[model samples]
Target: MTGPDKDEAVERAELLLALRKRGIRDRLVMRAFEQVPRERFVEPVFRNLAWNDQALPVDCGQTISQPTVLALMTTALELEGTHTVLEIGTGTGYYAAILGHIAGHVVTLERFRTLAEAAARRIGSLGLANVEVFLADGRLGYRARAPFDRIVLGAAVEEVPSALFDQLAPNGILVAPVGPPEGTQALMRYRRGPEGLEQRELGLVRFVPMLSGVAAVL
Candidate 1:
């Protein structure tokens, strides 16, 4: 506990406090936030800002989501140790890395090859064996790993894609932002019930729009 180690610890504490003030009380989500090192997920140039309550840029124009948003969304999922999670956006794999500590397995998708490859490397370096990164259109969902216990979309969409709904296991939970790409989106949580899908509105948030098809350009 010296030099950068001490500084990072302090920053992490402050970040957690901020999350608490924002009303995120889920113990498991807080523990995951405290455990994952967000600095490792951002570009080296922006590492200094990693602990700040704001999104920071990564490669391929993607930004590592603000810790507050991540914490809130994770809390909304009410994850369990046995749950298998699906993450739609894998920017820097930070969220996936956090989920790795909570969920049994995390399967994350990144449309950009560079982001997906780089995220895989970072997650590997952390030795998170339960997390897997894929380069593909997140909208399609992963049928091979169908019926996820929990699914979260990192980017904003006009509505939750039908494909994602199909992939959710019975009684599964899902969280996403739903609204027009240019306007503020409502953060929503959905649960598949015996009769139909039950929805709850969490809050408003702005995120990069969800795009279809795998990215061709860098």
Candidate 2:
């Protein structure tokens, strides 16, 4: 491959190195990031920004979060290959693809019908059979598939929904950006152990607010 394909390959390699230098320490998470091509999830006009450490606009006024944030949150989960994962905020289904690559199965939720449908197509295009995308309210989670071994909330929320907590399996790890909708939010990791729920902050990040109810047609 020559021209743009070659340039993108070069840029993707450099981006992986940059992510490592920035503290993406989990080997599995890093490998998943390495394997999932970011360009496929972004619009053609924004393909050039796919490898950058920045979020890009997507359908439904949402954004595909930057790779750094995705990697950090994923690493915090300490995800195991056998774990079943639930991702709240499918966006472009980018991170879900990464999770699918690293975990046993991934169920991602998006409030927007269009984004959910598009993301499903994107994941399917990659031939990731372990990943499933749904059009639903992320706040409620996918109840039929409860007790997820790992849960990642892609959007920031002022309060972590109790329903999601109920969906987390015992000894599971759930990572989310929790704080006010505006300004910076704490990237929190919650571990549900036999003793109780343990909490820790991964770092700070800015994400679009996680909304309730399904989005109406635009």
Candidate 3:
């Protein structure tokens, strides 16, 4: 292999090792992390640091989530191969791609059309046919495809939106970061059971605020 290719392989190996050290234990989640090349989803300027465990700026003043956080959130979902997932934020399409690798289908909503379109193109280039990127208000969830077996919100909100709960199927799991926009958030997992919505605190995290309405940008 060429020098750059060899270097990237080494970087990727180190990334996986870091993730494993940081408590990423699920074999399927680990495999998804390895198979999906993060460098492909990041902006070209930030591609060199793609394997590093850090959040990088994307368009629309948004940030792609750190690798460890992404893996932790995905692992928390406890995804099955037959599940359909709704992803609230499609930033750079990285997390959605991971879901696409593990789930039957992924419907990811991005508030900004530009981000949505760019993410869609990137996901398409990777031939992840099960993932769909849509420009919409994530706070409302995607009603047309309601009753998702799994849902993940890439942004932070003070409280879980009732609309999102309505979209979840029975026994469905939704994982998200919950807190005020400017403060540290808790990574929460909510499961819809016959008894009602059961909540669990996974850990502490920070993410961009979950905004209302779609962006006017094209």
Candidate 4:
């Protein structure tokens, strides 16, 4: 930790240790979290806090989800190497990077064009060719890439959008927080079945409300 480079390395090591201590033991997920430098996904003003296990403010008034939350959601998806994953609410593109590590392909949607562009550049810099960034409303879900094996919404939606549910392949899984925009929300997982969608509420969590429509400024 004497020089900037050394310090950054030590910080990343400690962050990984913290994640391990928190029971994030899945080798693939842990490796993905460690390999993707959280600092690169955060603004320079908040770079020092990137290693902290908390949400960091990102562009468009959104927050890059806390590491624990990200792990939980990603784990819930149960992504297989060949599965195609769709991520709503791209935010800082951090989640997409992690998904790319686990899934065969990732299609992420963002409402803010500026945030989407920045995320695209960062993902490109990392040489993640599997992640396709879209500057569009996530609520609509990417129809062209329908029947996703796993769908993850980074923001909290008031209710599960029927459109998104329809896009899931049979037996596919979707994870998102559902409830009122202002109050507490429950992270729920839905698995498509022949009978219908089977839901299992996981836990209580807070997230920025998933907005409708695109941001004018982007």
**lDDT per model vs. reference:** 0.91, 0.89, 0.92, 0.88
C-alpha displacement of 208 in model 1, angstroms? 0.5
lDDT of 4 by residue, 1-218 (tens): 22344577777777778777867788898889888988899989888777778898988899999898888888788889999999999888999999998899999999998899899999999999999999888888889988899999988888888889989999999999998777778999999999999999988988989999998584
Model 1 spans > 4 angstroms off = 1-6
Please give, for residues 1-218, the per-residue lDDT of candidate 3 as tens digits. 21345588788888899889989899999999999989988888877788888899999989999999999888889999999999998989999999999999999999998999989998998899999999999999999998899999999999989999999999999999999899799999999999999999998998999989999594
Q: What lDDT tens digits, residue by residue, belong to model 2 across residues 61-117?
A: 889998888888887888888999999999999999999999999999989888888
Candidate 1 vs. true structure, TM-score: 0.95
Task: Give the winner by lDDT: 2 or 3.
Answer: 3
lDDT of 4 at 216: 51
- 10 residues in a row with least lDDT, candidate 2: 1-10
List the pairs of residues colliding in candidate 4: 114-218
User: Clashing pairs in model 2?
Assistant: none
lDDT winner between candidates 3 and 4: 3
lDDT, ranked from best to worst: 3, 1, 2, 4
In candidate 2, how many Å is residue 60 off? 0.9
> lDDT score, residue 71, model 4?
87
- What is the Å distance of residue 131 in model 4 from its true position? 0.1
For each candidate, what TM-score against the reference?
A: 0.95, 0.95, 0.96, 0.94
